[model samples]
Target: MLIRKAHSGDAQRVFDIRNQAINHQCVGHYPEADLAVWTRGELSDYFIEVVANTGHVAVIDNQVTASGLLDLETGQVDAVFVDPACMGRGIGRRMMDYLEQQALQAGLSHLILDSTLNAADFYRRCGFVGERIAQYQSPRGLTLACVPMIKHLAR
Candidate 1:
């Protein structure tokens, strides 16, 4: 497996992972994402517009299987997802390593993320301590649900 900064060419694979996260778990969406939910151009636009420091993707067997973003704002880790087929193999941990490296290099002292109900344990195992009763500021308003987790980078 290879991990790298996402490029325009990675639009499709990232889109699939994102949709899977949305549909299968609350790590990404409240409702399900339908197939053909977004066009290639739309996905690219989203990558550029919302993924924070662009995006990071993990490719295995020549296919993208995991993805996440380092949000410059608040140093929040966003959009972390690994294909369900590839779960239980530590792919998510590797992806977190990539995101954490970026955060540390950027001089960020903390990495924050909204942990899905199903992913709280995973995040905890990744060394993220739960910031219970936390709220996330979203476009809709402040999000008050979900387990908020944080990993402090050693200074």
Candidate 2:
């Protein structure tokens, strides 16, 4: 697998992955309409920002298999997902590496993320510690409870 920065063209794949998680797991925590609103290209505008920011993807045989983004201002992880078929192959870890390096270069001292219960352990293994209780806007209206984890980037 090769990792590289993602471009604007990657938005569709990124959007698809996010929707998969939102539909399958309450990882997104918002209602379908809200998810659509936030994930839509014109509304949330995260994709464009992610492109302008630090976005990266893992390509396996020329196909994007995993992706992540590091927000410089807050050092927050916007999204980190591996293709369902590519799980257990360490793609997630590689994506994290991409985000971490970007964060470090952006002079961020810490990295933050709201992690679902299923992924909290993964972040822990990546050296992020649970820092606070978190709520995300979801279909359930603040019904999403995630652990806010932060990793102090070692300069």
Candidate 3:
């Protein structure tokens, strides 16, 4: 697998990976209404516009299987998603590793993320300690239960 910075052309694929994870892997952890709202693809423009310049994607055999973003200024890891079919294949881990490296390069001491319920364990395994900090309401007004997590980067 190859992990690299995303480009403009990878937007749609990144969007697709996120939708796939939410619809398939995350469905059981959320309510039907929430899933419907999330999978409705409302963040299309943001993914298309900002992801390319600010995110990373994992490629396997020339296909994108995962995507994520690192916010340099905020030290936040945003929108990390792996294709449901590609779960347990270490793609998500690789993306997180890349993001942590970026954080270190930016001289950040820590990284944080608001992880969905189903993904909390995954984040924990990547060295994040989290708690139920708040409920995130989507633009469509669906409430998502999330855990805000933080990881201290090693020097």
Best by lDDT: 3
lDDT value for model 3: 0.86
Model 2, 16-83: lDDT tens digits are 77656555555344456654554454424666566545678889899987788877899889678777
> Residue by residue across 1-155, what tens digits does model 1's lDDT show?
99898876776677777766655665343423322332122455656555434688899988989888777657988778888888878899999988888888889999988876668888898899995755555432434357888889886
- Candidate 2 wrongly placed segments (more than 4 Å): 22-52, 138-142
The residue pairs in collision within model 2 are: 29-138, 29-139, 30-138, 30-139, 31-139
lDDT value for candidate 1?
0.73
Q: What TM-score goes with each of the models?
A: 0.76, 0.78, 0.93
Better of 2 and 3 by TM-score: 3
lDDT of 2 at 27: 35
Best by TM-score: 3
lDDT of each: 0.73, 0.75, 0.86
Task: For model 1, state the Cα shift of residue 32 in Å.
Answer: 7.4
